[model samples]
Target: MEIARPQTDARPSPVRGPTPGAVLALLKPITWFPPMWAYVCGAVAAGAPIGERWYLVALGILLAGPLICGTSQAVNDWFDRHVDAINEPDRVIPSGRMPGSWGLYIAIAMSGISAAVALLLGPWVFTAALFGLAFAWAYSAPPFRFKQNGWVGNGLVGFSYETLPWLTAAVAVLGHPPSWTMAGIALLYGLGAHGILTLNDFKSIRGDREMGIRSLPARYGAGMAALIACAVIALAQAGVIVMLHMAGLDGHAILIEALVAAQLLLMVWFLRDPVSRAVLYSAAGVGLYVTGMMVAAFGLRGLAMPV
Candidate 1:
């Protein structure tokens, strides 16, 4: 069955400025949590005293979440307006709530603000934010438009959301690159995030097929895509669990093992009815996934502290 797409007007509206609620909707505050949480995990894993310069920590969280992440959301929504007419018509741009090319304007302005804030945090953080902003534009805009291909697109978003902010915060606290061990852990979690992101593809298969978006579900079919997504997530976290055990953090490894096991059970349910249950699995599974991230961060922090 063909999904009905809402009628959309591509012409910019004449409204001078959209209301603040529209702007907020464009920025998508709900999408901010992942990167923010990753930043905090990095800070904790760095094991540096934070109370003295707590404000810097706070700033890093802002850069990771509301600034950089929010900017990405705006950029995505603007470029995705057409696809969203079918997948999510109520979105700011597609719904005409953000008038007069305001979505693009906000993305550009937020990119600048994110850069300015990142520069304040220091060069490494600034560099990370630059890469994030670059990915944001490329993932959505012309010339690159990585979102056309699920593999490249999901990889970029996962890394930007998980790996980049993580290292940025770690360097902010450690005043340099993190130890390879910490970097490796962050990489693993970011890789797992790819699968988490793929879960989002299931929601838009009809629209993506019509729009040539080639999301996992659109490309590979729901059951196969669900299996692949679960595999990617499981393998990535399996690597983390092994790394933790090798570091003698047996208890933390055990906790993540339990989390993964629980997630596996949830995956079973999601796989049985992938289209309707995708969001449900994401809610339950991602909670456990991020919990494991924090648990591993604590393990790293414990390793950093001396007896």
Candidate 2:
């Protein structure tokens, strides 16, 4: 078997420091919303009074979104700089906007900061943060660079992005583990987000294949990968609806079912040209999916409250 290597660009002289804008670009601020929203959902699902610990809520959000998630982005960019050279040459690291080893330094610094913030939040939050951090590194770094395989990579990202942050937020507020219902909802959403992560791989199929990354789009071909992504997302949400209905959350179940129905309709259109329509489905269909996550979280709030 021929070994494939990531294509790299000529190294430039290390810059003194990256500009603030470059640093922010490397962190990918737009990517922060999913985990931040998941944290908010978890907090709400915990059913604790926010009035008493507004500061903790804010801190938890910061930890989950900008600190932890941003660190992961930095780590990924650092390790995948060569890959980006092929897929997105203009990205900060490859373009030398972040320059030299600054990306690695930033990832390490943010990892420490995230740990400190998680420590202040609570033991459970700290534990979850540690796990998230571990997966963050494993997803991008070699040896266990999970990103080399689509199923493992996407699953790890989804869990770290959705479930871990949700659990951390719940623990931060409640000072204890979340209820079974809350945990179940978070897990289901996390599983569904695997499809979301796979959708992200669509744009980089060529680079992935060239570099032997084995992403879903690269391995199964775009059409089959699209079908698999849609099926996984639908099945996870279907499980959520059934669980919610059986738990006496009829209103929430009905709302989620409606959302799933709308997503299925969109999926039909998306399947027609999965490669071109992936981003469109991500924006529209995935938007509905996350909204339904919030709905499920709210339903669990009632169960979390003191009876």
Candidate 3:
């Protein structure tokens, strides 16, 4: 009797080993820092006009924005195991430190806690939290796989990351949803996030291409992708200046615009290369500029309109 030989299959060995700090890194806890500042600015913008409680708004930022974002990141890492295996083998699950299911449970639990906080704020905040959770889920899940949906994916993640936090802060203080000024801040931040996401795609171009992912860098070459990143940052900066001027927040605008221009120039130079270090620096720089601008705007506005 002739037996068919077992088919020969060749693939890289599955990555193994537990990283003790896997869960910490898996959450990308650092990413939530900038969003917290963004929400604080939103709170300032909301309460500045009529003078409202800012501390509660800040608390909302901590509980709703960063907490939820961290949880969502864990969920993202869990669902993205295959992609991570190819794009970032040393990551938490791919590296074998934490189990994928555990990550999912952690994300779910955190999301629940965050939603409870949102409910304490009000109905609008609760609605925003729900939307954010949905976006986070779809970002890496199979049905409506935003990560593979190109620009659509980027927009989903970007909007949730930047917009919802600001809206939540505004709602926490203003007792309602986003106002025109709040919307402007969201738009500006969202654009910057879009650039960051696109730039990140450049680092994973090869893996994305091999995995049939439709990321910006895979669809467009790295050079063009970086150029797009620069353009997005420019537009985001321009939006901030325009919004500040339109809102008649002139005193705040001057300082914010100057800082933004400096940051923009840095981004332009950084985007000229797809080097890993450049990308990392660019991400950090964006975070710094946003935080600094928020501080300058809120600080000056508060002083200028002293009660």
TM-score, cand. 2 vs. native: 0.94
User: For residues 223-266, what per-residue lDDT tens digits would candidate 2 score against the true structure?
Assistant: 99999999999999999998999899999999999999999999
What's each prediction's TM-score?
A: 0.94, 0.94, 0.82
List lDDT for all candidates, in order. 0.93, 0.92, 0.71
Model 1, 245-273: lDDT tens digits are 99999999999999999999998888898
Regions of model 2 farther than 4 Å from truth: 1-15
Q: How close is candidate 3 to the true structure, as a TM-score?
A: 0.82
What value of lDDT does candidate 2 attain over all alpha carbons?
A: 0.92
Write down the worst ten-residue block by lDDT for model 3: 296-305
Candidate 1's TM-score reads 0.94
Q: How far is candidate 1 from the true structure (C-alpha RMSD, Å)?
A: 7.8
* Candidates in descending lDDT order: 1, 2, 3
Score residue 249 of candidate 2 by CA lDDT: 97
- How high is the lDDT of residue 49 in model 2? 89
Give the total clashing residue pairs for model 3: 2
For model 2, state the Cα shift of residue 81 in Å: 0.7
